[model samples]
Target: MKTYDEKHIRNIVLLGAAKSGKTTLCETMLFEAGIISRRGTVEEGNTVSDYHDVEHERGSSVYATCLHTEWRDYKINIIDTPGLEDFIGEIISSIRVCDTALLLLNAQHGVEVGTEQIWDYVDKYQKPTILAVNQLDTEQANFSRTVEEARRVFGSAVTVMQYPVDQGPGFNSVIDLLKMTMYRFPENGGKPEKLPIPDSEKEQAERLHNELVEKAAENDDTLMEQYFEKGSLDEDEMRQGLKIGMLKHHVFPVFCLSALHNMGSGRLMGFIDNVAPAAIDMPAEQAEDGSPIPCDPSASPVLFVFKTLQEPHIGRLSFFKVLAGEIKAGVELYSEKGNTVERLNQLFITDGRNRHPAEVLRAGDIGCTLKLKNTLTNHTLLADKQSGKQVKPIGFPTPKVRVAIEATNKADDEKLSEVLAELHMEDPTLEIEYNRELKQVILHGQGDLHLALTKWRLLNIYKMHVEFLPAKIPYRETIRKHAAATYRHKKQSGGAGQFGEVFITIEPYYDGMPPYREHPVRETEEIALNWGGKLVFNNCIVGGAIEARFLPSILKGVMEKMQEGPLTGSYVRDIRVSVYDGKMHPVDSNDISFKIAGMMAFRDAFHQAAPQLLEPVFDIDITAADTMAGDVMSELQSRRSIITGMDSQNGYQVIKARTPQAELDKLYAALRNVTQGKAKIKAVFAEYAPVPPELQKKLSEEYKGAELVA
Candidate 1:
């Protein structure tokens, strides 16, 4: 790989919604730059960026792929990111390392939900962005409609840098408004043909050109005055005005292209080369101490590891973006995470799956290092001790859904955690959690597909067969009334017999109120609530009803009964049990005897008291486009959700409600379908609420029905 000067390098990211032809755009750029012999299609699954087997099988990118291309004396390092909202982490990482985000919009689809999502990210990062209307050769391509949608959704800051001469099947050329000439592509894959603007599109092109000039003029008073007075400006003046607007985020130049057909690609390349900002123009990342490291090429090294790939034989491959200074092979850098100094080996510049050797990678360049110790994604690497500051990690969306997984084979059980740990390192959005109580390992991610990919990687790469199951809801049992009880244990199995006596009561507990019984209780009070009634125990055993050494065993027995609730067999809660009176034999009354006595006494008391099963409720935040607000509200109502309130979020209507967790098992897909793929919802486990009588009965019956299956 040949290194280019800092000024000549343009770190760009191609980000958009799924199936927006982002991969095709990268392929076209590579082909146009003479890097590829022919363009690869997504249908054929031979694209350079979507080289991964999972991506080809799914027909969408799962991870960001880095590709470098030379266009018109400028080096454009393009990072093609996955467009699915579930895989949005890739987009965030790619956008953070790039100076410009080329948001590719399918001309036919116009502004999609994923487009809105990426736009939000760009707005948050305050990065310079350009809109490229792709698929101009498609039958349904509408450039004007797409441009209008961009202006409507993204605001008036979006301006046209070039106007398409014709759209759809006739899209063979585009007229550069700034240069005032037409460039048409010939059938052969070679340089485009320059020609005069056709009379047919002259009026529309002129109107768009004037609008662009007006937008650029607003950024500068001199340019505005010149544009208004003379009705035109020279190339230098226009470029200056556009640059000011783009840097200030006032102008997002829109370009037209057919990435699949290789039409209008050269023109788009020229625009990126001339208009895209360099590292100097982008915002300099600051450390936690609020000090900015001059992002200049000569400044000290400050690199961020945005990605980590675990290769089978070669170990870990850490990819990072250099924000300041040039980095050479065998350089020592301080790792902020580990708080230790580490040395880099040979640097690898990436192009799809291929890695080219580079002696030194300059600032604003993205490269990989092989086998870095203790380096993980989102870790920072600083040059020396003085400027040892870390760049904050880019924010990613939290995983909303989870699935409990176990090894399908007993042999793979021990290696499951180890394999999942490596997968989690590769994708930070994935979370692996172990529920000790349930004895289940749960994997959490953005959606089902995200979890599926994680499992796929585990089985294919790590050779681990895993079984996926729905995570069990942690439920508890509590009581409503109070009652008292007593029990005695006597076992003569052999020479050492077991003898112990326990007296306790079960009672319902209120959070801030006194016990339900409100009776003057004795020292030993065991209160158990089964089916909503409380059992209270009072034993005034003067001397030694229970042995002092067996108190732990008595409590252990009581806890065992609590877990095996009286009514529903669920874990019991809010019940107070006290050991006030008991009897014991000197040698026979051991921990075992006391434990058995305590367990029996608690169970007996709990059954006497009433206990009930409590189900978990979740607070849901549903945000949908205005078009689907009514449908979402209706769906929530169907799920028996309590409507809390509603509001607006970034043009989408947000509905906050509370619903049962059981109703949300397969709701991810249902919500997507109802909202036409524009709604986003998040639900968190809230406080437990009592199930209705009828619903509780129905659920109990269903549980019994499932018992037959088991």
Candidate 2:
């Protein structure tokens, strides 16, 4: 490998819907660049980008793969990303670092749900894009319809740059509208031969060529004047205008390709090398404080780790892009996250599983380093503390689905925890949490497929078998009215027998207000209960019915009962205990006796206080097509959801609703089916509300049954 300046390096990412030929296009690109002697097919599972064992089994890419090739003295770094919505985290991370996104659209299906989902990210990053309508040789291929759909979905910025000469079955060549020439490839489809356009297709080619020239001219005032004065501009002038248009997102060139047959890919790569923007062409990197960091090889070294992987033999692989200066092996870099110096021991250029050693990587180049002490994904590394800068991290989407997990073998519990921790470090999107209130170990991820792959990895890679179960909802218990009860504790087990009597009143606590009662103000303290709400203790024992020193013991006993409520064994909250009257024996009423007395009295009062169960509710925001809005709302209503509001945004209906957490367990899957996998939904905890009496009765009975079985 040879070092190239920023201008000679091009960083591009391949993005599209699943099965849209992203992996096949990458294989063809590698073969066309002469980096590999032969190309591998997806069915064989031997492509350079999809080399992992799981990818082979699934016949699709599950992780982003880094690969590069040299063509005509220019080095192009390509990030091949997975297309499934389950692996969108990889797509987002890869797009964050690339200067250009080459979106591949299937000619048969055109702009699909997956394509729209990824386009959102591309638009978010504001990356210049080139659309390639692939799979032209398929039986249902329709290049014209795909282009029309692209224009409709992406606006008028999309312009046709190439048209297939003959599509389906006999697709063999394409007409380059920019060059106004026919590119005819051989039967085996290697290097295309440039030839004059046939008379039968000359008229349509000329019309498309004129449209291309006019679009190019509209990008620049000077080019527009040149076109107006001379009726047309030259190829160089048109390319210059197109570059400006692409940078400003005013132009999106569409090309035709059959990646499986290796036709028209060479020309696409040539155009990418010649016209696509370079890393230096993108906006300068920014620090956390919104200051620009120049991309200069002589300046201080700065690198941003965009992706991290756990390779079997190589350990942790940190993929990073050089933002400024140059990085070499044995260089000490400072990480703001660790606040310690880390020495880079080796730098390697990766192509899937293959690693090519490189001595130095210049600014604007992407490479990988093995085993950084503290550098993880999204961490920035600088040459010195004096630089004192960090790259803004990628904003990953929150997990939408979750499941409770338990180790199949009880002895592997600790091992599961350790492995889950390591996996979180490798991929931050996979979240593992122990819900203390619910008493379950929960694993959160993007969707069911994301969690399925994670479980497979745990069982196959780490040999830790685990079972997935439904996550328990963290319901709460509370009282609705005031009630009073009395309990006496008396034991005659020997000398110093326990004897204590307590009279306690229970009421619903609200916003730091003391219970409505008359009490002496001598000693009053507010105790913040751990289970939310407050406990106000007033030492109104004017006559010393119970000693003042025993107040703390009574409060402790109340808190202990709050941990496990009298109804369904859930945590209790928002309740005030008023111990206005009690009897105590001076010799026998110790802390233990008063505590037992307090617990019994509170339990009796709680039963008569109209106890209720409260379930958690979540705020849900759904974005779907207008045609599906009615169906979505109806389904939500069936799940006990309340429609809060609705509006229109970006050609889709934006719906806001509130529903119980338990109702949303399978809502995502249902939404996908209703919208044909085009809906985007987000949910967050809102508030807790009282459960219906019938449902509460069912839950109580289930709890009692479980206790009996135990």
Give the top-scoring candidate (lDDT): 2
Error of 1 at 553 (Å): 4.6
- Report residue 162 deviation for candidate 1 (angstroms): 2.1
lDDT of 1 by residue, 1-710 (tens): 78876788898989999989999889888998988888889999999899888888899899999888888888898999998888878888888888888999999989988898788888888888889999888899988899888988889898888877768777778888887788888764346888898898788778878777777788899998998889887787888888888888999998888787787777778878887888777767767677786677887788889989887778889999888889999999989787778799789878788788888888878889888888889999988667668787777777777889998898878788888888888888888888764568988888888888988888888878888998876666776566667788898977999888887766766545453333344344445444333433333334655545677687778777876555445567776766667777878778888888889888787767765567788898888878788888778788778889999866779999988776665666678889866877778878777767777666556656766678
What candidate 2 gets wrong by more than 4 Å, as runs, is 495-497, 512-515, 518-540
TM-scores vs. true structure, each candidate: 0.90, 0.95
Clashes of each: 33, 0
- Give the Cα-based TM-score of candidate 2 against the true structure: 0.95
